[model samples]
Target chain A: MHEFSLCEGIIDAITAQTCQQGFSRVRRVWLEIGALANVELDALRFAFEVVREDTIAASAELDIITLPGRAWCLNCAQTIAVGELYDPCPLCGGYQWRLTGGNEMRIKELEVE
Target chain B: MCATCGCGETEPVIHPHDHAPDHAHPHQHDHAHDTRRISLEQDILAKNAGFAASNRRLFVEQGVLALNLVSSPGSGKTALLSRTVQILRDEFPVAVIGGDQQTANDAERIIAAGAPAVQINTGKGCHLDAHGIGHALERLALPKGGVLFIENVGNLVCPADFDLGEAAKVVILSVTEGEDKPLKYPNMFAAAKLMLLNKTDLLPHVEFDVDRCLDYARRVNRELDILQLSARTGEGMEPWLEWLRRGRHDALIQQINQLEADLAAARSRLIHGGGAIRRTVI
Candidate 1:
């Protein structure tokens, strides 16, 4: 699954940060996931559990913060909430909308000792 | 901020060193816990995206049209690539990178079709990431104003998320598969820019409905480009070849435009009596 690869990405990012931030063990990880990022939370957790072994975040707790998806309606010239990528613009009921936000998965903070 | 870990502490701590030496302090060594909170706003896919960006830059600099071909197993991706390479090799420089779980058979086929090919054995990996593509590109040199076809592992799921710095993702679907495959694997279909319905010769023998299949694909991606071609029998290959030629031509034009802009900038710097004259060679 792509979730497994994405978990690897998270581990890579954490490991790289450890070298720069001089942290050895990660106790907690605060991650921000967008609503339209298409990541299944359960699958991501399962993948993280499988991948976190032998890493600094092995015992870390994952705290996820979800952001709502937003898009810019081209016709109506308004920002509207979008549940999916292919969803029509809520304001004008048109499909010609550009995604403005909520398509990212980022690590916001970490608690380390 | 706490001195030991430099974290923001909400509760006030009693200062032991500020008191008399004989004064007993219970929380004297409490800071030894040394827990720290680090605020790091970092994208999880940054590493992969960085590699992909580098690959894209290299491709653009080299004027190479790199296409990532994705499909399920037995979708005839290798066959399509091999045939396409054979047809285009005389007019352009072509190379292929084959991704598979184990064997190098696809790479061998591409080579047999008369083009340089590198096989990336992913071992247990389900898809070829940008890092793997970077390594493959290092081994295989893509020609200027040519095509570089990256045949991804025979998977429709994991490959959809990983971008290998390709100009476009070309997905292949065979006629033997269900017509509703686009709906079943919407992620893959949605990620692809082009859908090549391969093995059209088998359509007469199979129960595949072309219209329904196209409708399903359109539902997933309304702007997806579709082409019907039988890679084996050389049927409906004209449009595919034309598309490749068009892509290569556009890449060449882009290289030319970039060179012209750089030259103009350098000329302006010289006219302005800059300290040193820097020349860029394409």
Candidate 2:
């Protein structure tokens, strides 16, 4: 699955950070998942566990925070609550939208000791 | 300002009266009227991008030419790739990195076409990634001066955004598919460097308009080369095969130059930092 590739990226990111910080162990990992990123949180956690067995993050706790998907309706010129990639504005029902915020998936920070 | 209606000019504020706090002197959750901002600046895919860049560099250093083939199901991608391998195998060493949802059918077909083939089962994944291709390269047993063709899963929409470090990306649309495909799936056309309008043999009976299709492809990607050919009848295949041969030849030369450069860099680095490194993967 492409999930594995994405997992590989996560592993690489964690490993790179650990190496840079000169940390030998990682106890906890903080991750922010975007609702519109098309990534499954459980699958990501599972992949982390599977790939971390021989790495520094083997026993790391993956703390995931989900950000809701939102969009800025072009017609209304205001942000709206939306759930999908193609969403119509509640105010004007316009298809054209400039995604303003809430779609973010990143390793916000790490906890290592 | 309110994000939804822009009616609430001031941000919402909540105090201790909004919730009853536990009498515990210190609490994890504290009700406050202060507003805060979360500043997220790092990309989630930052790490993936690093590895991808390294893989691209490796390909460049090895003088390896790569291609990603994307098309819809039943568009004859595998068949066309098979023909591509057959036609060019004797001319030069070629290999294939075949991607599919769950079957070894395409790999088997590619191997039968008389070249090395590696199958990547994406499970439920819809597209192929650079890391997947990197892993496949380990088992592909490809040789120097080799051109690896990646046959992506049959979909036009999802695969365009992911870059597999391909030197060239080709979009194959058969005559059976309507001409509007270019306009409908402009992303694929925009990403690809070559467009193969395959199954030209059926043009006589099919409603596909080649002129309109070419025009649409040009409209989307003005620089993309449009090749119309029927791999079955061998009609219009000469130019296609020739183009493939020339491109691969140039790619091989480029790879040789890269390997030479890498070798030189390793030699100089060894003088400064002594270490043993493997030269040939084969």
Clashing pairs in 1: none
Scored by CA lDDT, what does every candidate get? 0.84, 0.73
Clashing pairs in 2: B63-B255
Every model's DockQ, to 2 decimals? 0.40, 0.11
Best by TM-score: 1
Give the range where candidate 2 chain A is weakest over 10 consecutive residues by summed lDDT.
Answer: A16-25
Per-residue alpha-carbon lDDT of candidate 1 for residues B78-173, written as tens digits (9 for 90 to 100): 999989999999998999999999988889999999999999998888899897787787689877789999999998878887888889999999
Candidate 2 ranges beyond 4 A from true positions: A1-113, B1-45, B263-282
Clashes of 2: 1
- Docking model 2 quality class: incorrect
**What is the iRMS for every candidate structure?**
7.9, 11.7
